[model samples]
Target: MSKTKNSFNHFAWEYFEGLEKTQKGNTLIRKKGRLELICSYIGNEPISEIGSPRMLEVLLDIQANSLNKAGKPTDKAERCAGIASDVFIYAGARGFCSSNPAALIKSQLAKSSYGHRPAITHPKDFAKLLRAIETIVGDPNTINSLRLLALLFVRNGDLRRMRWADVELATGRWQLKPLKGQGKVNMVKDQVVPLPDQAVAILHKQQKINGHTEYVFFSQTAKKHQIISENTANKRLKDLGYQNIHCAHGFRATAKTLLQEQLKYPLVLVEMALGHTTKDPNGTAYGRFEYIDDRSDMMQKWADYLDALREGRDTTEFRADAQNKADSTAQLKALIDQLGEDKVLELLKNKD
Candidate 1:
């Protein structure tokens, strides 16, 4: 069909080209895929002709047939509706459409049933899970990926797509623009992860297999320099009897919970290590390098804690500090427990 430039299909492609100027990686790919879905239904129609009713019909059709990664129905419909709304907004800005139909119809889509990514948060339960992960026999890349996921707890996509150039083994830091934050507003543009000794050791093991390749986790069957599959670790976890109980991404929650409740690291440090953007009272976002030394110390301590957990030892008294001054710091812990970590830190700074 000969479609006009004002056709929904043509305008969507134009908007995607604009997105390409800023978005990249999976973020761009996902947006394009969602737009393609919309085009599949009404590509040849003029933008002004596709109203809220028509957009709702297309989205409802998608909701009826599509399933999300979790095999749930309707989540993909909501996502497509959102992406379609973005396209309409782009067109409206350029005078192609008067209003955003997709935006108006989002509420009519079927409600999705997805919940938080399942994770084993209890320390003892998590430790048992970690020990079980140790016995998983499979591709070295998948195995090492699981190991490092536990150690670093970065997003599953960030870990899988890690590049050699972004890693500095000598400096013990892995720096990159996180996939989730890329091309999005109010999201951190850069993330810097301090590599613990255990993580470095695991990377050294991976280096033997993929050091020559561009990606740290290299895949033979994939396109050149592509990393392993995103589900590789999760599939192994399922086989190891952790289905629905924990997943590769769940390592973040596992670490976040245990680091605060078990190991007693401050929440700010944990959140920073997890690559989350937090604004202070002045609405200033903290930089990636704001607390590098403290984060480095926290990373090492977390690795040590995991080792202790894997070995099935008492981790209640674990500290993220290098010095074994637990006995001397008993009063400090009591103070923190009494006044909270933030208040305790402020008190110490004031005293100093």
Candidate 2:
């Protein structure tokens, strides 16, 4: 009989839950929630004591089990398999087991593209989400928090880490140090995102809330706390009859879709707005700040357009001062080395 830390025993899930904050631990949690649910089916058997054959049987059993709350039995098993596989990878890394029984279980998932796609509901659904937010604004802090998220479109993780010092009232920007990108990669990673007007509105209101707290969106769980779980905002959106489809992340997709499809802005502009390009050619190259001033207006206008769209208005009053004209003589080639190469290639390929 073998006994070990990840023995697949009764307390194994609890042990894994303890690892949720560190990088390795956090990676597990990213998919851990799903995995733990599968583990629950394994009962109190010690995984270390169980041989590969037994593990395989357990996996198949979970696959066939009916999780009533999960609607269809196959869907529950598919999720279970995915999480179980994640555990195997983590376990194998630590030499717990070499075989991954849960691996390739997704091959059994029903239909195409996991049978689920992002849902873009009718505009009223989005309006209802905003209205849900409206009802909460009476709680001054919640109002500020929602406004910050709407304006910045910061990932739920990043916003939760916001601090007051990051806010520059004069510039209407937030200078967050040590971003989520830093934790995910080994290279030079911290980034500065300039906050637009609507985001600043949060701080403008925050100043009135005792004004001395360190966090811009401090959680009520503790004094001077800066962290707000991603679920905090998500739960609020769900409670108000809005599905996840129309919440914080949808706003980001909204920004990307409108800027890319509707507005026809340059890709780099869109990427910059979304804070893309974090390494090597992407890193130093994006730092040129060549169009920072120009992007300020573009980003602000994008937010205004989202406001209009959410308002169910056919006519969107754009910030013309932002749209009227481009006053810069900057060339695309100067920004992206590839553009210059592409031009050369075009000339070479076509002789006059």
Question: Highest lDDT among the candidates is held by which one?
Answer: 1
lDDT of 1 by residue, 315-351 (tens): 6546654255765588788889999999988988999
Which pairs clash inside model 1? none
Model 1 TM-score, all chains together = 0.83
Over 79-120, each residue of candidate 2 has an lDDT whose tens digit, in order, gives 566556656666666776676766755665442223232334
lDDT of each: 0.86, 0.58
TM-scores, all models, native as reference: 0.83, 0.59
Worst 10 residues of 2 by lDDT: 111-120
Off-target runs (Cα >4 Å) in candidate 2 are 1-6, 10-57, 60-100, 103-137, 175-191, 219-245, 275-295, 304-352
**Cα displacement (Å) at residue 78, model 1:** 3.2
